[model samples]
Target: MFWGDLHVHTAYSLDAYGFGTLRTPAEAYRFAKGDAVGSPAGDVQLDRPLDFMAVTDHAEWLDLMYTCTDPRMSAHPYCVKLRNQSTQETGGTVFRDFVNPTITQAQPAKADVCTDDPSACDDALLSQWERMQQQTNAANDPCTFTALNGFEWSATPNYSHTHRNIIFAGDNVTPTPVDYIRFPEIDQLYSQLEAGCRAEDGCDAITIAHNMNMGDGKSFDVETESERTLALRTRYERLVEITQEKGTSECLPDYTHRESLGECGYETYITSHSRQKPLADFEEEEWERMRSSYARGLLRRGLLTYANRQDAEGNPLQVGFIGSTDSHTGLGGYVEEDQWQGTVFGIGNFERNMSRMGFNPGGLVAVWAEQNTREGIFSALKNRETYATSGPRIALRFDAAKVGEVPACKAGGALAPIAGGTPMGSTLPEASKAAVFRIAVTGDKAPLEKIEIIKGTLKGESYEESVIPVWQSDKGEANACVIWSDTEFEPAAPTYWYARVTEVPTPRWSSYICQEAGRCEEFPDADVKIQEHAWASPIWHLPTR
Candidate 1:
């Protein structure tokens, strides 16, 4: 099993400065090492060392927001406007509100800066960005610690659209990172990378979309500008961060009442901070507006719907799942209570220090790979044989096949199939004699409770769902190997499969800290807050053959 964090920020990111302490790439790596044990901002640290880590900071302007605005990088239209906006009394507040929850009202206000000459931006920022990319690649160390070349493209349409983080598997690539500032729209950016990769040898990349819930529901909109046809969910966008520091982007408590209680009540990504309003009071309905949009996106177009839509080519597109901490702090794998590093300094802190804190401990990206190495881990991630936890090195594997399933440990014959064959995101050509589903979930000494497969399928034009609780380590509440076998299938169901693992109880970081510190009131709600240990695979959607 390999452990890492795919979503991380460094001083190179434009927004990391106002919140974090670490600035340089080497400093970020050291910070991760220190934060792996703990930090002052809050609970952050990994119980174990990571096999790999990707320092994925925002690509737009690359670190120019903090640097170009230095007045040293030369005065450009965007930089000048950014400097002006940064100085505004309401600037930070407005920017923070647009983090994950609400639409950014700031862009429209800044529209005037780029209105006259958009190409003016092209000439001004390119050199500084190239230098930053040079620095990022120079910091890569596959021998000492695995470094993933990656960047976050801040592409949000109306505060709601697919916001993706692109990561490369190897160090040798060409050109530099291209974020929203350069290309603005995702489709255009996608076209650019695809063209570049096809033209070059040994050039490959993957994009992971995160915080879809915050995107006013447009993140998963299957359609392009023309609503007549569904957009293409590319194989390039293989993974989605279902959970993050902003809050779990998996499911909402209110909307997903019947399925499972989601982490919805937590502080939202967007608030009216820029408008002189405190971050304390939250409007539930306003939050629901965003959540409702997300649910609607899922319903109107099934998970990864854009992927398989009929195109000129008969090949289908596929998408997968992973979780990450959008921690502005440079530290990665920080999720322990005693060691939590604020996701956003002063903002992520649940306990008020001076003001609102955006800091949540850094998170980890988990993969079940053959070995703990760069190529091994990268291969696992690209193949979608991976899962993510807020922070923990949990090993989980799920498989669906023609014959009934068997454990990798108990299957006895060979574990080679687990490697050669696709486990999670890859699909079977057609339904077989008997569909065997197998899941092996292990926690970091945390007692296992349940493991189940949540499945959704398309029936004709309408979609239907089913939950198969195939394994439960606790039978009537005792430790046992909880496993199940299902041979029956609704012949016509266009099925997709993924697995989830739960702890015996819950392990909310805040609750654990309060117990050790003997401070309950200092916390919010304990009973409602239990740290869950789980992993989800990419949905292997088997559309009707």
Candidate 2:
């Protein structure tokens, strides 16, 4: 299996640049290639090189950032104001100019800079887009490192995050990004992608939704989606980001019945840009927000929606899970807790030094690929053969099959799906009443304590969710393999199951930084312990039609 980070930003992203990020796409790709890069503290390098990555800079202000940095046009008065005191030391005046337009507007348009010369905006955007492609292609090495490129369509209307990364399969890509300003809605984005990326044109792409925990109960807005849009969502979006610097999108403790020990409430972060109140502040809408803002809830909702209706498509929200650093400074796959730095250079640095500790070293995406080439990695991603980890190189494999139909795990020493059985992110046998699931894992730098089988089985209109312990050990086992049977499984119910493997409790990224700063007591909320874990894509058993 190959490990990579698919969501990282360079200075080209407007907010990242406003936060005084200096690393560019080239530097980000080289950093993933195992080169040391300059940072605020000093030179920083990854402990290990990544097999693949995508530089997903925000598409909103590429033209403006490019205009401000260009030697020719940068002398303009508007560009001058944008560059003045843009770093964290000064103020967020210009930053506010760029960000407010995004979250405040129902359909965010170009900033004040766009009004000056709209054509120039297009020219600069194309220039920066080509620059990203060239720089990424320059660093791509087949069978060693795959440098995929993409742009983040940052939609933050009403302080809610509906962000999606538009990553290309190969060098052939759209001439320009379909951003929020021109094409604001998800339907518009999908239509443009389908129109742009045609098989005959040597183009292919996929969109991965991130920060659904920040989606404010509307990320996978199934309540109002049409059948066509749901189909489009299934076609365009295959994977969702399970964890990142901001926090984990797996579940919230109160939102999920399976999570009771507060383990579900891990690493929740609210960015400084949001004006919305905390999750606890909203009384009536809080439960709805919790339900829609999590992966487990969204998956269950998708299953139930399909189970009840024939008008909608077949489980349109059936998707895989992956993790990425979401690093704004080009530090792709730099997820080590001990060597942690902030994702956004200025804010993370300022917050860490002050011991505020909201952000964290994010997670990683591991792929089961045939080779290290772009084709292999992209194929694995398209097939949903991936797992996500919270900053560890933990290895995990999950597969489900009927009583005696499961194949051996010795297929090249790894598990593979066979007839009457399915791997993670797939549907099980059509008529099987129950199945046996295999959970295999190996920890890194820590030992496994528990392996949880989180399940949601349809019980009437809603689902009965539970987090059952499949295996446990107190002696800190480094490896685990368990075969668990779903004896209560019903063939008629719409059900989904996934594995959550947790290591023994360890110091969080904040704990390490706060302890070193000697302000652990002063920053009591920041200093805490957490169980770093991995989430496998779910195996589904939808109601038989």
Candidate 3:
């Protein structure tokens, strides 16, 4: 399996550039290849080289930044305002003025910047896009590393984040990346991709939806939509980012306490759209809306709603899972807990007691591909044969087979699919009475604690979920495998099951920072040690098909 990061940003994103990241697209790829790249803080590098990466800068800011940063336009008043007032070191009055009301609020381009020439604005955006494409292609090494083409389409309305990262399979990409400036709603972005990428042969792309925890219920709003719309959405969005710098979108404890007890209460920061208040302080309806903002919650809600929405492809709700760092520092796969730098460290001076309290070191994506080439990695992603890890490069394989079938072990200790069975992120054939699931995990450095099989069943628009502990290490076993049978499985129900592997308690990134700074007592509740874990994509059983 090859480890990689598909979501990252460079200085081309004006927001990141304005904040402090100076690393260019080439520098970002260099950093991911285990090279030391200069950060605003200092020289930063990942301990290990990533096999594949995609530098997804913000698409909305490409033109405005290109227009302002052009040497020819150096003396223009608009460019001067961008350089002088917007950058954090200078004053940041203009950056705040630009980002909030215009970008996150999802408004039109600033009139002063775009001016009267709409064609010129389009030209500038296309120029930046082409430059990014060229740089990505140049950095790609089918012999050494795979650099995929991608960009972020950020849509944050009313402080809610409903964003998507567009990743192309190969050189055949859209002439222009669809951005929120033109496609305000998420549906428009998908339609544009259909028209741009899929219109031409040999061109294919998929968008990874992320930060559903902060999406304020708009990230996966499939309710009241048509069947064809669901099919289209399922076709375009094959993966969901399960964990990231913001927090775990897998599940939160607060929702678990009241609803599904999925044991998902770890690193759950930034829970609300309005403020940094806890879920207890939120209104009942607003708190209820949070069910749509988590991965597990999305699965549960999918069971409730997507019963009849299965397309010719499969259920619209079944999505592959992956993780990545939304790091603006242009540092890909920099997810080590020991070598820590805050996400928005302008000069490495992160006030941990303040905004940094909610953030972590981010995560990585692991794909089981045939080779280390772009075609290989993108094929793995499209096939939904991928898993996500929280910093550690834990190896995992989850598979399901009929009760009488036997699971095999591959050469690399990975679990091989049974003769007539399905693997993770796949749909199973109709079962007889029960199904046996084989789960294999190999922890990195840390010892294993437990492996849980979270199962959810749909019965006429209402669902029930349970967490079944399949295996737990008594000794300090960092590696183990188990074939657990669901004796109580119901053949009539449409269900989904996935594996969650937890490690022994270890210090969080905040705890490491506090230990180094000798400020453990300063942030009492926030700096507690955490159990880092990995999540495999779900295997589903759609009975109606």
Candidate 4:
């Protein structure tokens, strides 16, 4: 298996650049390859080199700030504003008054910037796209390190985060990125990508949604959409980011109570944001809406939607899970708590350090592939043969089959016969005997806590769920495996099973910050210690009629 981080930003992004990032795409790739890079906090480097990485800068104003900063382009009015207001106070105002309005509303800048010609704007964007592709090509090595070309489509409608990172399989990418400035709606972005990349020969792309916790319940909305819309979504968007620098979107604290699970909350940044104050104090309907903004909730919803709508190939829609660092400082795969760096560029002083404290070191993506090349890694992602981790390099595998047959080791494998079952991310076949699920885990940084097999089954219009603790380490073993059989299995019901591996408690990122300032008592409920964990993609068992 090869470990990688697919979502990251460099100085090309206007927000990262305006905040303080000075690293380029080349610098980001170098940092991912284990080279030390300069940060505002200090020198930053990954503890280990990643097999692959992608620098997905925001597509809204790709390289616009860098272009405007050039002396030759100072004739433009926007360039003049960027040159005049370089301070943090004035920069924030500039972002609110000028940048935010232009991108969010899809409004063009003053005619002076474009000089009354629309193609001039397109030319500037195309130039930046070419430059980005060139840098990515220069850093890509076939077997040593893979650098995939990608960009982020920043579609934050009404201040709600509905963002996606677009990753291409190879160096062959679209000539221009489809940003929200042109495609205001998420479906429109998918349509443009289908025309530009997916339909073209030898070019393919996938969109991974991230930061759903901040979406205010609109991130996973599929209630009243048509069959065609669902088909299009399932075709391009196959994975959702389960964890990131923003927060873990796996499950919510309140929703876990409804599901009869233990405390599953950790590093929740959504509730801490000022914009989410209304959501944090939700009354009735709004509180219920919170359930739709998490990974587990979306999986349940996807099962319902797939049962109703079939794709073009006549297969049910399934979504896999992955994690990324979402680092804005051009440091990919830098997850060490002690050697942490700030996400925003200009926030490093004592007072500004509080802004950085809320963010964790971030997560990593693990793909079961044969080689470290782009083809091998991209295939693993497209097939849903992947897992996620909250910084630790924990190895996990889940498989299911008949009681007497040998279980397959890979995820997303289809069931062959009634006697042999499927793997995770796949549908199970009809069987007479009970299905046996095998789970194996190997921990590196900490000892094992407990392994849970969470099962969600749908009956009629409602759903029933349970978290079965199948295995626990009595001796705190680093490696363990369990084979669990559902003796009360109902072959007529539709069910999904996924595994969650937890580690022994360790100091969280906030704990380190408080220890340095000698103010551990100030933040009493700040969750100083946490148990790092990993979640594998789910395997489904549909009713065989």
Sum up the clashes in candidate 2.
Answer: 0
Quote the positional error of residue 404 for candidate 1 in Å.
6.4
Model 4 residue-pair collision total: 0
Poorly placed runs, candidate 4 (over 4 Å): 70-75, 83-91, 108-112, 253-262, 271-274, 278-280, 310-317, 345-347, 406-423, 430-433, 519-527
Candidate 1 residues 385-471, lDDT tens each? 777675655566666543444544442122233433347666754545444555655555566677766666666666555556765
TM-scores of the candidates in the order shown: 0.77, 0.93, 0.93, 0.90
Error of 3 at 261 (Å): 8.5
The runs of at least 3 residues in candidate 3 whose Cα sits more than 4 Å from the true structure, single-residue gaps closed, are 70-73, 86-95, 253-262, 309-313, 345-347, 352-354, 408-420, 431-433, 525-527
Report the C-alpha lDDT of model 2 over 1-545, residue by residue, as the tens digit: 89999999887876777767878898899999999878875788887899999999888777777888642456766677767756756536655675667644743334556676778778889998899899999989999999887888887777778889988889989878878877778888888888888879988888998888777776577667877888788787888999998778887655333224265766766332344345544455565565465788788777777777667767778888999989877788998887885556444463644543566789999988889988888888877888899889988888886556654543124444444567787888777767788887877898989999999888777678899999898887888877788989888888889999998988877678768778778778767788888999988887665
Count of backbone collisions within predicted model 3: 0
Per-model C-alpha RMSD: 5.7, 2.8, 2.5, 4.0
Q: Model 3: per-residue lDDT, tens digit, 34-58?
A: 8987664577777789999999998
Model 2's TM-score against the true structure: 0.93
CA lDDT of each candidate?
A: 0.54, 0.78, 0.78, 0.73
Best by TM-score: 3
